[model samples]
Target: MKLAIQTSSGDYALGLIDGTGQLVNAISRAPDTAAAKNIGTLYSALMQKAGKETSALTGVMVDLGPGGLSSTRAGVSFANALSYGANLTLTGVSALEATMLDAKRKTDRPILAMRPSPGGACFWAYYEAGHSVASGCEAPDQLFSRLATEGKAFALAGPLRRIGTEALRATAAEQIDIPAADLACFAKTTPILPITNGTLTYLEPITNMDGAHHIAAKDLAS
Candidate 1:
């Protein structure tokens, strides 16, 4: 049995899949912050629903994120701990790569993935012919205009769909929600990290500021 966890977005989900990447059951919930506290309860509940124990898991999967820092950290931390504890195989999933995969489910047209950055401009990645072409940020006031100039109709998928679609002034032909249970199924068939190293992927640098004030706040939070 395979278990998957995704906290890369506001919607957190736990998914289970069989050896053939078939979904057994999945659950989702949205929590705005402090994902660290309740993930254990959620995981236990899901396992109970599946009538399985955590040790029954043969492999584990997680979304190594470019989303909210705390949520992503909590998920990865949990996956790492579980992998280290149970000695189960683990793999990391990239949200952008998944977006490209989801886009390919339809027409073979080019794909554009955009995720909102910390400031104003969005982080963008593109794929064509089932391969990445380029990835960068959209120029100021040109997020929509740049796509218009691409001269080819493109499919869209990612966490930033709502804001990105609004900026485009056009409706998306396709927008994939990360919480979709099938993502876990697809991960089974997809090439993944051969071993779990407990590392994570981040589009924007993951940093903990160091200073007296920063340390004080972090300590207090802890």
Candidate 2:
């Protein structure tokens, strides 16, 4: 009874993954308003499908950003509130990390997960040598420039892929876009571990907007 929520894209996703990693019930919708507005509806629908109450959920997981700020906040807020109300543990996983985790399971090649940033820059991260690495913000040109120096075969995932082939071509980085199903599968194996036991301690808020810039590159330095 692990509940997962992801609102990284325009569409919102809600699902319950059983202990065995099987999808018990899932729903996705492109809401007219912000993702926050549809939280209640999505939660209700999932509960109905599962034939259980929110209180019955064992743990809750949320895809914390590298995506839309408002959407990420909304999803995290909703997940936090629900976890508090239902007495479930909370785990915050990076959306990019999850994307790469999904990609790595599918191929042995290095992975590069990209998402659009607020300022027309890109949120990029790399997974290689069994470590997830965060690369700071980069304009289209900077990203490609760095990729040229790295010269690694990589796969891409997330909403940025939908930015169109022309946009990807503009980067001149050799890569492939992965599907969401792949991400969902990756979540099952290396799922975000709970940081809190459904209590005050479990709510680790990511307050700094510039935190990604400070994400140490040492972990991913290979």
Candidate 3:
């Protein structure tokens, strides 16, 4: 079994998946008890409910994000400690990839996945032919206008849809929400990396987007 954690966006979720990547059980704040502060306790409860133990887990999967800065840091920190102490593999999933995978289920068109960030910036990724073509963080005003000028229709998926403008909606073929169990499924294929490389995606302020690159997971520890 594998353990999946998604705490990006300030909402917490834990999922248990089998070797085949099938979700065996899950707990989320939306339907479960509010247990964010006591994740270790919650994890124990989840394992008990699933009739399993930590020894059964093969790895840990986490959503590395352009998300709530403090929350993302907390989640990744916990995941890193758990995987290291337990001698288990650690896999990281990006917010862009989660949105892209969710959008692909609804349409075959190219996907534009966006996650809103602090200071009026957004983390965006463009995918074509099932591969990521470009990704970066930028102000929505400039990003949307540049995309519009390209004249290519895209299916949109990500947290941005909840707070985006009508003009943003009009630019997409369709928009969909990121699935609640996104990391659980995406984790199956995502490569495992050393605990040293298990870093979270950190989105800096819009002022720094001009020089931004995909930040490494290790950088966040410093």
Clashing pairs for predicted structure model 2, backbone only: 196-202
Q: Pick the candidate with the highest lDDT.
A: 3
lDDT of predicted model 3: 0.66
> Model 2: per-residue lDDT, tens digit, 59-163?
888877667677777888888888877778777767667676766666777777777776667767676754665565666456666666776567666565554
lDDT of each: 0.61, 0.65, 0.66
Local accuracy of candidate 3 as per-residue lDDT tens digits, 175-202: 7766342655555344434333345322
Instruction: Write down the TM-score of every candidate.
Output: 0.74, 0.80, 0.81
Order of quality (lDDT): 3, 2, 1
Candidate 2 TM-score versus the reference: 0.80
Q: Please tell me which model should have the higher TM-score, number 1 or number 2.
A: 2
- Using alpha carbons, what is the TM-score of model 1? 0.74
lDDT of 1 at 155: 71
In model 3, where do residues sit more than 4 Å from their true spots? 30-34, 170-172, 179-181, 195-222
Cα lDDT tens digits for candidate 1, 115-159: 555666655556777665666554424655655554556776666
**Predicted model with the maximum TM-score:** 3
RMSD of 1: 9.3
